[model samples]
Target chain A: MTRIINRQPAPLGRLVLATLPFILLALVYLLASDARLAENPSDKLLPSMQSFVEAINRMAFEPSRRTGEYLLWVDTWASIKRLFTGVGISAAIALLIGVANGMIPYARAPLSPLVRALSLVPPMAILPILFIVFGLGELSKVMLIIIGITPIMIRDLQLRTDALPEEQLIKAQTLGANSWQLILRVVLPQLLPRLIEAVRLTLGSAWLFLIAAEAIASTEGLGYRIFLVRRYLSMDVILPYVLWITLLAFITDYLLQLLSKKAYPWYHAQLGEK
Target chain B: MSEIPSIQPIIEARQLWKEYGEQVVLERINLKVMPGEFVSIVGASGCGKTTFLNLLLGTQQATRGELLLDGQALDPEPSPERGIVFQKYSVFPHMTALENVMLADEFAQSALFGRVWGSARKALGKKAMAMLERVGLGHAASRYPSELSGGMQQRLAIAQALMKQPRILLLDEPFGALDPGIRKDMHGLIQQLWQEQQLTIFMITHDLQEGFKLGSRLWVFDKVRHDPQQPERFGAQVTFDLPLASEGAKQAAAEQLQQVSNPTTISKEQQHDLSNAV
Candidate 1:
């Protein structure tokens, strides 16, 4: 069995470095907030000091409330279940269409120009058109997200497939491997690393579109909740939801990196570095 | 050696012609190779020796002639029946030595086994191990091609070709990449393997010494033709069938083998005296 080592661990020095910036920012904010706290604070410093403190606090502790309070506690089990099912269905559909279109030459040739043109039209630009067609429903939001992500995913997948080594393909041909066999045995193994990279990138694009999708046409979801808070200028709730989205994106990207490393160890070995 | 089988010729090329955009590489080349017969084609750099090997391996198609294998029309497709070991040691670098040998077995059984990993895998693994042992690479089976020396890599390539159970082995300068000492060892290993398997081998090399050491019958491609009417001709083809005895005789004969470096030097007094003495 191969021994996997933990590359990063928390030590006193790391802990100090992590907290140093925040600590200095807090001190500056406290001193400017009041003349008594600093020995001398002018009227011009008061408003700026209050805003800085609010931003700092918002950044520091907002995520725990979003994940622990809003996502896990208030939303309950049903809401989390719906989020996963919706995302899973969207990802599966996008992957199937992307991979199929990417692999077929004629399909890619005819559709690539249209897809490139569509990608330039921002997800938000289609909101009014989508709402007029599908109404302000869950389907409209999911459709919007899918349409926004499919083109990017397809482009990435196509580039990955095209970038495969010619020698491997020729070897497969000389070995008497047919089309399907070539794809399954030779192409797929070589494409795994790039495909995983595409997935990570597309996943980020999906999240960016998620907020737009929900803000325009949806009654529920983390994005909808954040939009509802924005109406009242409730920075606390808005900050927390944004924090949740960022954390989820980081976790998903990290998971994909780990999975790619495990599934395509040969690629990493070829790179001659971890 | 084992009993010489009365089987038909393994490879036969008749009036074979290969050309690249009006430059005729080879023309009207006819040859037949019997089982267990070791033949070496020695020629200058552009004499189409490699092209001939490629034709036999089915990697290259003849421009205007017929090539047959055991009385059947040669298929313009690569198969395990004709294994090729190239000068570059064309073994897959990512694969271990054992895996390279096992690739042939895998390809042979793929049709019937349908990629199932059971008896076919076990049998191929055993055969690969035995082949590696024969090539003196049993201990290095787990090592990648890059980790092995040049001679070891060539040995592994030979073993892989042999593991395919090819009817005839085509080697295009298999030991041309090795040093002189390593080349001699590889020649010995090739001779031993051919003797043990009774493999019909056709090798192409510019090294006259290697050809003489390994080939049972040596063929030289000279541009000067021997015509009765003309006392001297600029271009002709000369074929020498030297007898192989002990190492000393083989070495001496190899030294006497003339190269086609200069077409005009064909009638050199030294060559005339050597030819007359032989």
Candidate 2:
């Protein structure tokens, strides 16, 4: 059999292709909401798009009556701050240990097994332990993301570092790089794009851990709001909040992909599929 | 003329035997390579060619005996004193050709960030560009190694290796992966660089023609004392060391012809001779 495929699609074609699925999904939701509302005008399980828009506008655009501030925006800031802080620290630690352990055999021999074993222990299972240890503050929540995601990130990066050509390492050494210089110059630059990819992969689990912690106990977050409004059957607010979270995650992933391509053009070029 | 410095051996390996407790890999390998001499080591697969190369590169420690670079005992770690070009995957794939060439200069100035500022960066860039142009990669300075063709990648590898101005350059079948046309071009480039740089080179190659064409000295590695009863008793050794400067071409031609006729005959001959002597 023969095949014909275009590697580069036109912008309009791409745009259509990207939005077609979303458009269909929106249609399904709208139809489902209409049927539910026709049966029961006050059904909270399937709220109309008007209600969704109104709920989001009230939460995002208008100041809350109690707090005198936009709750949605506030939640965005707080949640993102916590998420990025934990992820940033995790990436740094993963890079440090991953490069060292990957490049040096002695470091790898003992540490790799421990990292692999710990990554297996479910982070949610340790959530209560972390809460007890760190208390019901930002510390515990952030600790969840770190402990849940860092070991896997470290392992991901360590494997990348290990897969690095021995020729490159030897070449750097021959160019007068000591171990420190080798890691810093040759290995680190190469690892950055991979680190971005690793972070991207762990973002889902990171968010899962974050939401789990927030749902269990937290004053304010996307998860806290969704679970809070769940008691009152506020489907309008919950649905909108869920969509907003999805949007934020999408934007983050896009930005990271953009960063990797921009900062490391060589990597993108080699990937063969933008 | 700089007083025509009498032949000084830049690299010396004395009875360098490498082995595990149960297996002997290389045994009693003795050789001296002079400065500015292109020496080629030829052998069949599994004949300790890479092992000998690694021993010289300091990646592998000989189980016994010693290796000296410039009359000093060579430390068993890779250093700037020796540069190497492999068959493939030599250049840093993540960097542009120019960046790859300037890596050593950057490390020399600042080991941490590799940020050369002001006129220094300009100077290094110029030097690196010159090397790239010398290797016929002037237009490919910004291309990644993956983007370059196999021949171009080999050229980039050579350029990167020459960045440090090492005393000796090691090439482990650098052109084996290239097409014949490109290999011929690479041969010219290597010979030209060797002449211009006054470089001492130790190249490991399995191809007899390529070994004869690029190098001035030839060393053949093979297992000589192959006793089926005690197969691991003796490892590969330098069976023939022919200096191309003097009547060496004839010896290389003989070995090449012999290789073509029967690849295993040399090893068998050496084994028979060793057994008779024993």
Candidate 3:
């Protein structure tokens, strides 16, 4: 009998195995679209590949007569700007709060409870409250993403810091390191890579909050454009926009992983990851 | 072991007691250690061996009494006067071997940045590289701890610890995780370092033979009294302090070693008593 547990695919075979599901998915989509279009040429549920192509060209290639700008590019730029701004600020805040909560008892006593309480509250449920406080502008949209993900990132980073071996800290102290020196030298460098991992994990949620906010109140964003066409049941435009957003998220996640690999090879090495 | 009356002890513990809430870990430990002594400690698991080492390293403070160094009260915090190497995680994983060694000098010279650049960095690198070579890790200067073997990592940790030129070195089961073959090499390395640097060393070991073979003085930590109803009421203390320089103590160590090796000949209770009384 063949040993299933011990068997693993070779590199080339693994690549083929990886692509098999995606190819099957596309084929299924194509066949379903063909069947739907055969019944009714103008069906909105399953738009044909030809309609998808035409929608992409109109949104990406042609400038609108009223706005005189490519709609897809404009929306993409707005969405990306808001997403990165929110994530960047959250990362900065998480670093400070996490280090404080992990290292010092005085800071941890109060801040840990606060972060725990904040992380428990559902971020989407506070949409109206955020709009009322920050107003319906870019600030409110960015704030929504921040409010959604910052506490979680802070908790993760704090736990990572707390999990560092006690021996390392004692060794640093024995080497004549003061409090600030220990933080700058011993703790910060180890934490940078973990911060990146935290960001990578929360990027999905950040995108969710961003899209939700933009769909509620915005003039030009990927979420806004998708919601704008949904009134007429324009599946062709909506489908491509969703695919583009997925592609962007995939690229961002990929680049973050690559950056982590290049910047902190020791982390991956310790985890025994290639 | 005759001693000069004018000579001063490097470390002295007077009625030292370490308690955690209601549980007593170490109790009434009083001893004096001269400079250039290699003291090996042996005990059972959870017997407060590491706690004693931490007390020496200044990571943990005694609940009562005094721990002194150089005729002054030792600080309750870790300082450069005492350096320590643990069984694991003593060296920073984020740094290369050279960088780890250089960190001591960095922390000393640049308090704010914890870094030095330009010519200062170059000079520090040279010194760190020399220290690494002394520890037999010169060829692996740029390698991170993750890429190193267990023995090599321990050597790197030793190099990092010695960079501050601490007078007292505390090693907490540093060779316990190593293979037998690697442990012999480490023993040789440690002996040579202790002699060359004039370092007072305190090492904890579970191996009784290793404790006898390496230490100039041997200490066995065990509870002299135990209560079945309340184990936390008692704490470990130095039950045996043998100065191995004397011929009589050396002969006793050999007999104890034989008794330990041939455990089936004696009752388990006798063996426990023998270990405590060694």
Candidate 4:
């Protein structure tokens, strides 16, 4: 009986050694910046730090205000709620349309050229059209996000579906699988890994589009807050929102990858080997 | 082998003709495989052995012949009556070994949903597990195909094909990718499965030794030319049939098998046949 053990993990010492260059660069940067800060302590550094802290505190605690003379502060909960609703609806629609298009060859073949053409058209190019059709409401914003992300999702699904191993398809056909069965059972399972990857890519693209969508006639969302602060040249307020969005993207991408590994362990093992 | 008498031919191909474009692969090929019979089709590459298996499995259409299953003409539609295992990795890579086999069983019982309830799914899991055990892969049942070694993956493929309780099993070079030792083991497993399930198997192999070891009857295709003496014979085609049982049959079979196993052994007769096979 042959037992295959996993390859040994790299030693901790060697792992630390591998990070030496990045660690050294960070140390150099910290030392150089620290010297400048120490030499010019009277350059209103305390007030700048105080302002940064106040912006974080404000975004975390106080909710945003829409009208004038009412000091508005964006809260974390509102930002999260807007992100969840916007990304959730956009991803769901994109995934459904992408998967449906991928499964039907007739649809994919005729629609692929149109999709390719549409993908080339920037989301911003059709903002005016969307604004006129759906108005400057949440529908337009969500539609913009869908437009930005759908092409990528469709292309990914199409490529993954096409890249399925010929032998597996033949085997499924020989096993009495109909087209639907083949797609759901054999093809979809094989597409799971790529679909997860697509989700990550789409998530990032959705976030990118979210900011733009929010900047355009949007009342809610981190994007709107960032845009509003940008008008005032209040970099402090904008910086926190940027950091929050970055953190949110990182967390969502990480969660998606984690789910992918759990759902398709073989993908993780193969990737881990590489 | 007393149970053999109770078994009947499950797969019958009558005058099967398969052509692709201008090239005819199998012409007027007739074969009857009895239940529990381990029939191996041995030929050089491009002799249409795989095509014959496809026809039997109903995955392909015969150009001008009829294929019958248990006295009925095989439906062009796919059915659970025939299961096929391929030479390459056909097991769904995203699925575990058990899942792969279970999926086949589920597909087979898709119509019995009202009567079976969730029992069918449970039974499928149990059956898949039993199949894994039979193939000596019970411990690796949870492992995905890509996680398994090449030989193990092929074994999983075999299990998946057989899990459907198919009346006839079609194997196209099932062990063609395995090493000699693993191939021998897989052959033993296949033979055991055939006996246990009373399965009618039509296996295609380029390996002469595999044909000898597993095939109850070996079908060989010899190339024929209209003008044998012509320096460049133009009208050439394959004439395939079961090898004749003669005094020199065993020796000739071994020689041909050797040529197939080792291409460098390319004897003059084999080369002549190969040239005419085109």
Candidate 5:
């Protein structure tokens, strides 16, 4: 007679428990969609699974009438290019500035205050300014994502570097490491995995900024397509696009986590014990 | 103090004092340490035993006097000439035990890269492996510090420190976190390494028995004067300096240390006499 609080589920039971909410939500959506469509066949909201599947098929497999290109693939590639470019630049800048800020007082004294202040400012508030400065091109959209996430990632990495045990630094110095060597060898290797983790954490916000920028000004992108179709109440296309973006984010996060675990097994091992 | 040997002292501290603003931590510490002497220091917590180790390690500068290494002023920064092992976090968690040992040579040979490659890396790996075998962590060479047990990690730390071939080794309670059984094994390993390397060692310990069992010389740090109003006004000094080269001297010093440490074992009158004698 185990108490409910103390009751434990077996592996199969756990799997069923994990998917229960999603299944329930899907069932409710199907019932509501059926009811709406029965009353009004042309209902735009909560499209049926059949309409969703047809919309996905047209977007993914068929060629567009105007451009003769699969619009879905084109939009995905465009968005991914901007996302990765912005995130890549952010990662490089965060690594260099963050490690410097953590290890050197001189580096920290000037930049840390500036980074802290920048992180406090709402990144979305400056979207117009970024668009004005960088123009309504790819640069502005990429800049938005970079500006949104770079400061946060830098602050995260700096704290991680600062949190490194003082003993390791001393031990490295005693082992004849110069300041540069200390940063390059002892500090950089350890902070790289942390940078990956920080990037993973910030990917969601990066997507938000990217989509906002594209929705405002873009020729063709997932966000642009979704926003363009919103006028006609194309829930089928828009809902699938949203789900696609979510799937992409999940896959990217999973890959980065796998990279961290594989490339830096010692980091994960250390985490497990400490 | 015993008579100074004719051989040139490897390290000499002349009126060393460390003060933090108005507070004193260590005061008037003067000593002449010959080469290859295993000096074990024991004191109550916050008596500046670790501070003395830091001064010797060149991580902390003395406020008032000179700390000479090889008859020259010791550098204000740590270098390969002096190696140190802290109680914990001494080993790099990101590195395998073998790579940790090889790090010293890598830093020395490749100043810019902090690593060697190809043939040079292979050769260094072999040398590091030999050192690992000496410390008895050869089998766990590929294991990360976290994967190894505490005793093995400390052995890895010792092996890493020895890679630089330092003349002096500073250990700040390196075995404090270890279980007693594991600690004994570490002691044997350290003693073997010390003797084999002819290393001049300075170890700080809270365990009096460990201090007596290991060192050729024992240093007891205690305050000569205490202020009832302000404890920070007075600083600790080497109150008891005993050379344990002879068995009789070791036994007598152990008894004295026991009495000083355990006040319940002695009457108040005897305790008063002991403090005055110190």
Candidate 6:
């Protein structure tokens, strides 16, 4: 009998609405965990809240008896450093290659097709080859991430560079900028925000490559820790580690988004429409 | 007659024929622009005015011709000696007015990095601020181009272009998008800047009265003057070139404005002719 209104809710209402799903998910998980634990007290798949707390305390607070170092901190540090190194190298090379592809004919003629073909080759397929070439060290794991993400990032950056208004390039030339100067000055500043955005977009794939490489080999990493304990169905440690990786990814994405907003407000405004 | 060498015009074009494939854009353009001249061009859409300006800007090469700028052979390359402003898309939208103006200075001062660090940065900032002030945008230095009014953005674009103190300034319908009032203000500002800086300016506009008002000389781009049967065969050329008296142009321009405002009195034939002239 009453009329139904389909109007958008206010900010507070929207926030509550958004959080509702997460709260319901947690509630369902907790209930299932309780039911499983009541049926079988010795169950390890669905660990209790007390078990999670104990695991975190031991991993975070207590040093490893073998190496006299906190394994959790060690793993987190190792993974982060390798991730950044791989991503950094990829970003630097991609920026140059992408700019060349967009700005110069010689580079685009050869590199564009090569990058397209490389992007089609599933990076996971080359994991074994990378290990064979670089050995079972950090080099191979980092290389895997780089080879996986660089082509896509390069393609992204080149497209963005190409999409920029031709007038700016012309304007820069009239302002006394040489070809190299134009690329370094006018083109680079504009592409940076887009580069960061491209990096953010490819992070999931980057992390996947990193974890897969770690799980297959390596002695110390979040991925290595999870796989090492998997034989005994150590869901508690695995679950926390997965959540930790997700948390780290979220923070990285936020920091990058913040950097782009602060450094290139104009780019963000341009993208805000989309 | 043989005692002195021939005086070179600031810009000289000889048999400048521009084409794309079989399509002729600009045909047989032979003209000279002397130093300190305010030349305005008017034309209909697709008459190749933009293409001509591009040639002047060094962004495009003429299919056949020898172009001389400042008595030197014109190459198909852009350099800081010539500056330009388009109808729109002039300023970098991602930067503030201050950053936009300072970008060229930064690049020129430091070739690769394009950053002015420490005291040098401060000195550059002061210079950029002065340029912004020259363009009547000193107060809006921190504002983004998107935040500025249309006229303000144009002024910022002018400031950015003038940072290098270019030998020649090219404006392609620079104020075409502004309102009538803002456009009038812009006209005054450009006039003042031109006189103070002693700049050589070439502007392309669609309004005949605007061209007549602002320019010392006017170049008309029209396909009608070439061939009606082969209208598409030929693009445009400098069909009519006329110099305006400094005083009479203002008065005549005012008269033309009044005449144009009286739309009801104008016959259909007059409107048709006006449309064709555009």
Please tell me which predicted candidate would have the highest DockQ against the true structure.
Answer: 5
For each candidate, the alpha-carbon lDDT, in order, equals 0.66, 0.86, 0.90, 0.69, 0.90, 0.84
Residue A107, candidate 1: alpha-carbon lDDT: 68
With a 3 Å backbone cut-off (N, CA, C), the pairs that clash in candidate 3 are: none
Residue-level lDDT tens digits of model 5 in A1-274: 8899998999999999999999999999999999999999999998999999999999999999889999999999999999999999999999999999999999999999999999988988998998899899999999999999999999999999999999999999999999999988899999989999999999999998999988999999999999999999999999999999999999999999999999999899888885
Predicted candidate 6 versus true structure: per-residue lDDT over A107-191, tens digit per residue: 9999999999999999999899999999999999999999999999999999999998998888888877778877876788889
Candidate 4 has an lDDT of 0.69
**lDDT at residue A153 of model 6 (Cα atoms):** 93
At residue A221, candidate 5 shows an lDDT of: 92
> Fraction of true contacts reproduced, model 6?
0.69
lDDT of 2 by residue, A1-274 (tens): 4445647668999999999999999999889999999999999899998898899899999999998889998888878888998899999999988987898899999999999999999999999999999999999999999999999999999999989888888888889987888888788989999999999999988888888989998988888888999999999999888888999999999999999999988888777732
For candidate 3, what is the TM-score?
A: 0.94
Model 1 error, position B196 (Å): 1.8
Residue-by-residue lDDT tens digits, candidate 5, B192-262: 98888899999998766677778889898888888989999999999889887677777677557646654
Alpha-carbon interface RMSD for all candidates, in angstroms:
4.5, 1.9, 1.2, 3.6, 0.8, 1.8
Model 2 ranges with Cα > 4 A deviation? A1-24, B1-7, B111-115, B229-231, B246-248, B255-262, B265-278
lDDT rank, highest first? 3, 5, 2, 6, 4, 1
**Clash totals in order:** 6, 0, 0, 0, 0, 1
Q: 3 or 4: which has the higher DockQ?
A: 3
- Give me candidate 4's TM-score against the actual structure: 0.78
Clash list (residue pairs), candidate 4: none
Comparing 2 and 6 on lDDT, the stronger one: 2
- TM-score of predicted model 2? 0.89
In model 2, pairs of residues that clash are none
> After aligning candidate 1 to the native by TM-score, how far in Å is the CA of B8 from where it should be?
3.8
